[model samples]
Target: MCTFHGQPCTYLRGPLPRKRRKATDPPEYRSQPNGSGSGSVPGMTHLNLNYPHGLNMTIPLDHHDEVEYPSPELLEALSPSLAGSENLGPAHRQPSLLDGTLGLHLKTHSEYVGLTNYREPCLLDLHPPEDPHTRSVRRLDDFTIFMIHRDRETTSETQRIADLDAIEKVVHPLGASLVNLYFRIVHPSFPILHKKVFLEKYARSYHEFSPPLLAAVYLLALDWSIFDRTLSTSSWQPDQSRLEALALRTMNDDMKRPKISTLQAGLLIQQRAKNNTWTFTSQLIALSHGLGLHVDCSDWAIPEWEKGLRRRLAWALFMQDKWGALVHGKPCLIRPDEDWDVRPCRIEDFPENAADEEHDPEGSAEVVIGRELFLRHIELSLILSDVLRTFYTAKATRRNGTLEQIGTIGVAELAKPIVLMLRDWYAALPEALQLQGTRMKKLSANGSLHLSYTAIDLALHRALLRNVSAVAPPELRHAIRMGARTRLVSAMTIISNLQPEHTQSFWGFMASAQLASIGTFAGLLWATSDDDLEATFYCERVEEYLWSLRVRSQAVPFARDALRMLEAEVGGLGPVRASNLPMEMMRI
Candidate 1:
């Protein structure tokens, strides 16, 4: 996909023979959503500006075959609060924390293009069916070639030998074709010695590629594999080691992006308030993952996709220094924030008179709801802080050649400072939330725990996004957006079901934060020690207590189910399975 005047587009390959199929056939396929569950609504689908005639489109069989499409009126009735939002406000004109010198001044315009925005997407001529159909035919710069063999059909051992032999036969041609494709996708800037080139050359001789190159190919394969599985509902399991290696490489790549000086990120937050596109701001909840935020809905027995979206959105808000409230008539921390040593600014504190994207005060109801959702986004940077520390430390150790033990005390030690920061923020909860007498009758009493847990989960979500985004190619940014959107939708749906009066109340925030925090701590603590027996005991007890507290247990099937899956995957004593323990200990 290419960014044209800041908008994104997927360029189709040159004109090909067109044989119209019957109307009953599925529509032509476009790109797939980067998430699962409750696929994108129709109206929101990208406008086919390039095809006035309207290109054919196809909905997945799982969703399309079984679920009826929403009627136009029904779609119109959807909560505008769910529409995507982007903070495309004008750039912050002020000096930022990271702006060390005048020369270091980063551009703050809507036109600003970061490394993430670099891609020229021209769709390839290859349109292989979801499954292996006819022989694969890929178009090279100079000629079209038929695949001698499908990579998927080969075993690892035979594939290695085949690749070695294949390199001797087609390496020179394959390398040239690859370079041509690379230039088509992105500008060519690196010297011949760049690792990317070296890796690509080595990729021809699959056995000769270094760990990083192999990891990149694995990640690309994973992305393709996941997309195929999601769209086709085919269960294709990848080697766990391959997934881990891919994740590690992606994390390292993310660190290389001119680190958005903390000051720059902060400035973007403030500037976004005044100049961002209404879509970005309104879509805050959905874009939470894109921004490396989290959502924690472990208390709820909701769809996994929804839960993950909410957690990420909450964390994104937290990262932007936009959550908190008054305690004892004094300022206090509501969501974790890095700007405040004690607490940070809340949504209510946003500059009221800042420029808005939709100048029309009387816009559609969807626009209004979108604005409201943006304002309600959870703000918790503590999650990102923890995630970064956790991922980097684990990665550093792994790079040192200790793959046998990935998560250990050394990793947990790296994570402790960030966790302590969260603890400190929780300690600053309002007097009502902390006091025994007031807690018995107020929202704080019932909701504080859940909110605390949600806060921590938001952090974890952010970390995971960071981990994935770090290694993902620029082409996969859409997937990242999908990931963030799914989480936002889930969180909003969960909150919408709550007592409307309490949805924005301190207790409400506290409840969500509490649930996320619990999940985060549970995961991290469990990640620390190698003793599966002990971890299982803790997980089971915690799960039981969380269920007992009526912490919206139905809102987060992803984390819960993943835990179960992980247990099954890991086998033996682990976070997934443990002797059913009492909820009593978890409360403490």
Candidate 2:
């Protein structure tokens, strides 16, 4: 059978033809939330403006062909809280500590771009099924043409490759150690690059790897250099700015002939907020579609290893899409009812069945829970993903403006499923993934995962508060209030537990500072929203987190800037300035 990406071409009933719309046909226009190509922020114009690549955004399949996930009932029955609040360590019992709060100065906005306005969306690049035009013949670009031959690159691509020759010197004597650091620390959380193939390829020659991928590896590793004994003591300190600039340039070049490596570089570099923007993320999602990573490949004619890799990368992209949309306050690119088709990741999909472990050459420490963190993080993303569709969507929020209009039982009923999902996620955590009394660790392998859970939980509880008050049903309001306090406490506990390992891990560059700021806000809101001694209790934890933020200020970018904003907002939050909270949330 004739196929594309090993699936039958459903429209190939006859030879290809080109036909235009007749005047009497139905209008084929619809609103594309955030997936359109345009310039609001990053340099999105030059990337996807005219790229003509086909994407199988939707498939007609039998009812039984759909994927499945655990039900809320099953999730709620999974396990109790791994770190039960009442039993939390001395931090919970001791008198509140107050050193003060910490702040960020990164300029993501250009003079031309406003931080609030979205680009004017025109039309979706996707082919509408009801379009009045007939399908045309397929076309290939030079990058794809050369990739099919297996032995060469296009001339322009070769020129692009030559531009990154300086990377060889950038790694110099520490290249191997940096790669090891990546596989050890960053890879476990991100896990985009496969261990065996990457190492095998590197053995052949540095050139065996794409400049973007190679450069991204060493660049991310540099963030964790202090943890590596060999490189930590060596006098060689590479210019991170030069490395960042090189990775960014090569990554943009890699996009010309978009491949798996292109997506890899994009995901890696974007881990740091300093290196990413909403525009850049949209470009990555577009490239992922161009490469056909969105479609299911379970039965494709590919190696078993490749199938697994594709699934992992697709889910990783999904996490990026959902989280990026939340953080960027942009429309979500992946619609659950539309373009998202990949199934939830399976255990077999990871490169290693047994979690990978790394013993530093110093023989100082070993960590193998990277897989646990990666898997659980995906689950957490799925948790927040539902919030995006259910309650936070523009349409959903607009509808929510009415107070429990009619048919629905209001916010409580609507929140039940998400509450159950979060419960099950926490309950199901393997022991290796659980935290105790917020114990600080030197590595904190699973720390980021739990910390992220607090961030997501805080978001949920905060949203619930708008619909709740003393007038709301007593039990319902109490539950939400108690839950919000719990999440704030959870966040405070984890924030103070911050370690170098956690800060330098995957997404460390941005997540550490951002989560800390979210926790501090949760505490402030708790302290002011209700009058009780409990406010002081929460404030003490906030102070502890602020102290941690101060200690890690140099290690984590934007830590102090985020704190300064919090202090300013707190200062201005007289009854007249409470409006600033939403702005701060959006900025964070």
Candidate 3:
């Protein structure tokens, strides 16, 4: 954090802009960052190309406003023949970028940088995280909000009492059971909070924790009351509205002095606040950057354990940003090239590990599986980022930030390397992570992990299908259609394997949104099929998936809703063909 007043700021002993890849590390992705020659973050260049402080909007409407309006010039580049004057050469062939904007240029990942926006309340560092508050506090509106302090109606001591009273009123008498339920069921899959640290603090006193965070913990745990037999049968239920209101109020106040707990609370409560999906996620990312969560903390002069916790939290947010973008049809808040610089997490980074299971009584084999599930999710988020970057970027398009793409890029060529990456990822997946067969009795991460893969693959294939044109290379169009179908069928396979146990896992928390996506994939296959026999096969499998959802309808949240979506998606597909031949679909 030391800066020379006379000169441009430089780290005396701090880590580099971002971490670089080492020789020992496996080269998972070969695509390199396109613009910057070196992988270093915008350290001095930002100073050289200095401009007024950047302002991030309080509302997540920046990307929303970047709608591309076609001018005559762009119209020609995207559809030259449509201009009625330009020649449709090899480069400007029909079914150009218009077919399906399928183009990818990738870059290899670098080493992990230290914390960028991490704000340690009291501790000072000789070599602190590279990204400090000064460096990341770019957005004017955000900084303005951060600076504004409201007039208080009461003294600090009185406010603290009031906050505690509010929390105590909402918290259950057997809050310990609820906390235990969270660790047992949810923590394994989503390890945003350090179990040891959280338990230690709660044991000391509820007041030891932030008000928002404390309320958030109990509130989230209550969602799974059924898991606790006693809580399930009890006549009393929590006042969810009150707890949520208190969390929201305290959350706003806590932002004045942000901490890791703030992020933990934000991520936990993200599920309940369905109305604020886009704005809330955007705010979380902004807060994280300001707190330096995006910076690598490998070389930070912090406790080794804290470093591990930081890495876990950082990746958790990373997963949130990538998935949120795809689900909401919004742009990702974090950028891989300049924004990310952390090393891939190792087994030691995760709080729960196999060796620790034997030492603690509460620790079980589930902890071991849960950590594996979490790590795998982080890896999948990396792949999903590439999918968004490679195929969905504005590299080939004329506009900088618009979603409306206009390019003549090779869609099939772009998919090959990513396709290989996905294949290798699945091949390298640990056998322990592989769950029981379809409809297996036990529930591990099998369904969530499998379905996640299907969703991402569907994204890749679906993009290709959109580019399918009569004038496009027949082979390319045919291949894209088949790949999409394969992904649709993959969705069915994952859906069939789902059990009641999965509904309680981390993925289960977001099941409603994901279930809608599954329906979309099935619908894409059903609506786009030119062949009647092939369409029938998709319809039958989708119906089977509907039946599966119906069986789990009572136990799972929004299962009935998903079932209805699938019914509407396939039922309204198109004119029903005469019941003639099932062989049209039976053929592989």
Candidate 4:
């Protein structure tokens, strides 16, 4: 009974009353550790009584049967919370529970909590905040601060300080001669760079110009400079490898912040670097897109010169992508439908130098010689792009069916329109750009124009070669074989007439590879032809062409190897057919 609630209360000075036990109960429950008799109270049962150190007891009761108590040993196993918790008295001791549980609440907020939940260390701030007064006080004055800021702005500029003294020392007084050589030799095939603007910029500090462009100009000029006694007899000739490395390094550095000058530099590097043209051209395409060069700028409020530059640069990239596809056997990157509305370039786009009467607006020389070849080249490239889309693209091939379908009848059907377009393109070429006999140099732009035309024709007809043996209707097979033979003969004749010395004048890698491919194709044609007279004629002509290649440039080892292989196959003048030739010999 409770006394505070005014209920009856019973007070006991000793332990609580125990339950009464029957006679059959265990003796251990009746006897206490002090040897005194204490019976179990009602509603309680003594389950066990064991004494090892002090006292250990187990009681079973009717009311609370599920109560649990841990051993004292487990209670003492906790880690220390404070430095001297182990030495603390029982009343003062506190348990140190494991982290990330109720024990976390026991620890101080600052001790357990962190700025972030992750276990990784915090990152150090590289650009920490500074006081405005500190920043202002560090400067000497307003003029000095302005100068520092100006220098910082200039650091982002693409133009770097070129060693003009070294350049002047190398070219000496023959600077004009080198410039002339570049325009005369390299500009015709690669008209992307404007000669008039280049000279105007060059008149200023050479340090202000892009290093890669200047290096490319110097390297290309060095080739023709060999023919000039003024530069050739100089104390020092420019090192080709060094200049190339410099141009490549500068191009790579400027690639991150690409500009129109950077694109021009890349094109120049592609022309000189033989193996990296495809890779560089692909990257250049991406860079062009980043600058919005793919979009038409006619409506933009830019200078007329800038608009012309954009058009030229855009077309140049288009041509690069197209020709790169043909040369590398890769897909074209620039799609006609997706490209911008940049119009065809005009003659006025190319600035005229006061001293050059040929560039006069009223002069016929400008039409005949200046920009005519470039415009024609662009037009032909457009046609080539159409041909690639119509026949070679993956979507077109899928639409036509499998490779077998394309090889059997699809190619012949597609070749009709492309061949007609090629014919029209050739007919429209200016008479000045036509490849005339001994009157023109073999490696002139005229020669390149004709070679491009022939190459496209060959590419179109080569698809039919595989169909010649397809199990198709007799009339269809005959037509395919006849068509292939005509194109092959025409390609062979065109290649045969090319003076090997003139090929050295060409700048692009594609032309050289195409020539080798033509030679290889002719060998396959000669081997496969049923007509002995025609086969012999082609065989003799190809052999002559291969010999010319072997002597003209050591760069084309493919030609040398192909010549040997072909000579081996036809050495005995034995009867050979396409099936007898190894598959390797038939590949371009």
The model with the greatest lDDT is 3
Instruction: List the candidate 3 regions with Cα displacement exceeding 4 Å.
Output: 1-157, 272-276, 355-365, 394-409, 437-443, 508-510, 531-541, 564-571, 576-588
Instruction: Estimate, for each residue in 1-588, the C-alpha lDDT of model 3 and write its tens digit.
Output: 235456554533323223333445432221112111121231111111211112111111112232223345644664454443233222232211011000000000012113342533222223344543212111111111011111122125356557856786776565666777677666777788766545533543455466777788788788777667657888887798898889888878765555567778888877553523877889888777655667666654333456677788889888888888887777778898886876777877775555444432222126677787788888888999988886665553224323223321366667778889888988887777765532233235556787777778878876666554446766666777777776666676665666555554555334555676776676666656667876777677666677778887776656766666656655445434423325333121
**lDDT of all predictions:** 0.30, 0.56, 0.58, 0.54
Predict model 2's lDDT versus the native: 0.56
Number of clashes recorded per candidate: 78, 9, 24, 6
After the best TM-score superposition of candidate 3, give how far the Cα of residue 335 lies from its true spot, in angstroms: 0.8
For residues 180-210, write the lDDT of model 1, one tens digit per residue: 2222111111011122222223322334332
Q: What tens-digit string does per-residue lDDT give for candidate 2 at 229-299?
A: 87899988877888888888877766665667778888888887667688998999988775667766554
Relative to the true structure, candidate 2 reaches a TM of 0.67
The positional error of residue 128 in candidate 1, measured at the CA in angstroms, is 48
Please, what's the RMSD in Å of model 1?
A: 24.6
**lDDT of each residue in 171-234, candidate 4, tens digit only:** 5556556666666556655667655445433443355355666776776778655555667677
Ranking by TM-score: 3, 2, 4, 1
Candidate 3, residue 57: lDDT: 12
